[model samples]
Target: MWRCPLGLLLLLSLAGHVALGAKQGRVRRELAPGLHLRGIRDAGGRYCQEQDLCCRGRADDCALPYLGAICYCDLFCNRTVSDCCPDFWDFCLGVPPPFPPIQGCMHGGRIYPVLGTYWDNCNRCWQAGNHSAFWGMTLDEGIRYRLGTIRPSSLVMNMHEIYTVLNPGEVLPTAFEASEKWPNLIHEPLDQGNCAGSWAFSTAAVASDRVSIHSLGHMTPVLSPQNLLSCDTHQQQGCRGGRLDGAWWFLRRRGVVSDHCYPFSGRERDEAGPAPPCMMHSRAMGRGKRQATARCPNSHVNNNDIYQVTPVYRLGSNDKEIMKELMENGPVQALMEVHEDFFLYKGGIYSHTPVSLGRPERYRRHGTHSVKITGWGEETLPDGRTLKYWTAANSWGPAWGERGHFRIVRGVNECDIESFVLGVWGRVGMEDMGYH
Candidate 1:
């Protein structure tokens, strides 16, 4: 073997250490020729693209300008998280220790500094004592998951006169709650878990309320959301998501049974469980077992219609029209838009107007959600500005904001809640109540 020079041996030894580090997945500058310690972000909120690794604290042109872009490194990134990569906490949660946690967000042209209205981090903007799942999604994603399209011929859409007549400055009642008026009929707020079953839950709850109201408390059965989650498939996708129109159409065409017969099991599995075989199928199987000679009906099992809603119609987008509809026809389902700031709401009248920086137009087209509009009232703010609000029963359980309820700005059709309000008449009969 040839003997190597001392200087060459030293170079080889250094190279070995670098190669070992590279194999261990650590960021090595010498081995990575094209790679350099480019400043993650320039003074402006953009990525740096200088050819030199150390530019003497000078920034280059920006390569990326998105809010949650990633910058790769190791120790430097961890030490200077805010300076190097503002969104590092979002993706690499354990990497950079949040010593001095980031304090605010610049959303939709508004600067919501931490400690003023809400807490801020890379993963979330506003922070409040609300449900965890509330912050898991953005407004756009939530809207896509919940709402179906609206039609011009819808009853709610047709009443442009009602909304036009109602003035925003008009004085209304100090407070109103549907639960207080009809404590026996109004159902408690339900928890839809992470599944997109708000369409089903709201539809079922509204139908149940309508049936109880029409029957004068004789039919107080908790109608099954599982029935809709499993059976109704026309323009609906079960837990993944479905349309309000499709849900109402299913209720009108194929009725549902009590929760005791088919319980809500959508949240039991990862995704909503597969559409189960209808209850009649199991009944037929049991009958066949008892009477060996009797042949089971060779029909599809989903036809066992126990309850139905007739002529599903939409309520007008006017605050008065919605209130009138609720008073006359129990609770109505309304489609509203959700936003990032809405998740942090604890109480008081929820108006999306930012006191500091953002514009209303920024969150105007965020996420869509459906809720049961139980009642409406007006609140006087500290500045003496009167805010009309609709009391809504949410599907996030009682532990959520305002005891499983929320108040949205009314009269102006805030969040489009008044845009696609749907109402229905549930069909009830003596035979339906165990008259068999």
Candidate 2:
């Protein structure tokens, strides 16, 4: 009887030891290539206890916290962090590790750095830090610098007074409309906020617009700028103010789609479309679903070239004439000093000078200000400031008041204002001009 009991006790102890060994073995197995396990010891000096692994190099890069453990060894393990971190990893390797745990979110299978902005459902505006790289440049240089890689050739030729002539009733069948009559007329509205990929947004917008006009019809529906700005997984500069042309190349290679399809706010249940299962994060949704496969749209354009332009009118001494000529002829992108007064007038105002055009008093009284000039118009404000104004568009979106359109007071007889119009023009290759 004594021998039988002893044997039973021995068997129990052996089983317990095996169980402990199994647990330790599992942890050791997890510490594969590029990972070194560091075991902590107790006061007794014998391995007191918990075992942990310090990931090294490639494994460390793969073990980015934003993507979870799966991404560490799988998709990102072999690839350089530069390629994977652009749209995913929020934490910088060189920066000190954050004390309070940083939270991460996903959009379109890619992780985005969420620091300052509140994620809203309706108006998905992300508050991002200003990247100083984009400042200080002539409009031409800025566009060129931003579109460094994919240079386009076919330039959109604008005649002086095109904006004025295109307005309502001023000139029927304006150049834009006349171009529509031609065999190649491509025009499309680009959705601006979808992906925070402005480079793609602008590039695709310009390309598709030109292509529609030149190849298919007059203008195609506006391509969504939202997709370019928001959906790209390879770059993170969009919401922080990125270029437009670079986005086109990214989308061409990686492809993009609806934000609703990839919820970045931990609201996957609220996703509208079917989930893509083939992506790296698909397993998070659960098993049994087919893997999601990314599909590029057929409308993507691939040509990259440069174009040249001839001066329609040499700028003369008259600043007003120069401004008018630029407004009429080309889509001159410019950067101007913004003042509080410029934001005045909620909607309409009269100004002797363009500087005073958006005076706060006028904006408060009329509830509108014009930042962009399309053409000239005459309007009578409620404040009795009857002034001839130039039609302008605002970057403030449709909900901000004027449905994305506004007017600026270019000049009045009393105030001989000298408004600056920065002109940008270059020839792009005919093939570079994709569908509008």
* Best of the candidates, lDDT: 1
lDDT of each: 0.55, 0.29
Local accuracy of candidate 2 as per-residue lDDT tens digits, 29-70 = 334431111110011110101112223443433333322222
Task: Report the C-alpha displacement of residue 254, candidate 2, in angstroms.
Answer: 13
Which residue segments of model 1 deviate by more than 4 Å?
1-103, 106-127, 134-174, 268-305, 354-365, 430-436
TM-score of each: 0.61, 0.31
Clash count (model 1, backbone only): 6
For model 2, state the Cα shift of residue 279 in Å. Answer: 13
| Backbone clashes under 3 angstroms, per model | 6, 72
Candidate 2, residue 308: lDDT? 19
lDDT of model number 2: 0.29
- Candidate 1 lDDT tens digits, 336-407: 766545655556667664432333444335455678988988756555677677888887778777888888
